[model samples]
Target: MPRYDYRCRACGDTFEVSRPMSEASESASCPKGHADTVKLLSTVAVTSRGGAVPPSPAGGGGGCCGGGCGC
Candidate 1:
């Protein structure tokens, strides 16, 4: 299940709800029972379990752009 953030205009309260992706657009009520609510745009950060490392150049440091160009 994915979590969605919603804000209630009636009470000006924010709450989180967990539901399936199919119901992501469904309306969510506030904890205070306010129906005038709107879904908030949120950001999700996904990380790898193994901490994978990206491949670098043969020289490992020198590239077109200063110090951190993996190309």
Candidate 2:
């Protein structure tokens, strides 16, 4: 099974569903009873080990250090 994000055209609500690949593309309606819905092309974040790592700031700070954070 694969997870897919769907947006309801009638209600403008976004939700996620986990289903089979074949049904994923066909089923785009919201489970809350919205029929005029479409599947949205959502992105998933993934990280690689030691892949063009960015440099960090010299000083240690709280929260984000502003070191080329992708998030």
lDDT of 2 by residue, 34-67 (tens): 8988888888799998898776565434355443
Instruction: Please name the candidate that would achieve the greatest TM-score relative to the true structure.
Output: 1
Q: Give per-model CA RMSD.
A: 4.4, 9.5
Q: Which stretches of candidate 1 lie over 4 Å from their true place?
A: 49-55, 58-71
Clash totals, every prediction: 0, 0
**Per-prediction TM-score to the true structure, in the order listed:** 0.66, 0.59
lDDT (CA) per prediction: 0.86, 0.77
Tens-digit per-residue lDDT, 1-71, candidate 1? 89999999998988999999999999988888889999999998898887887766565566566356654
Residue 19, model 2: Cα distance from true site in angstroms: 0.8
Query: In candidate 1, which residue pairs clash?
Result: none
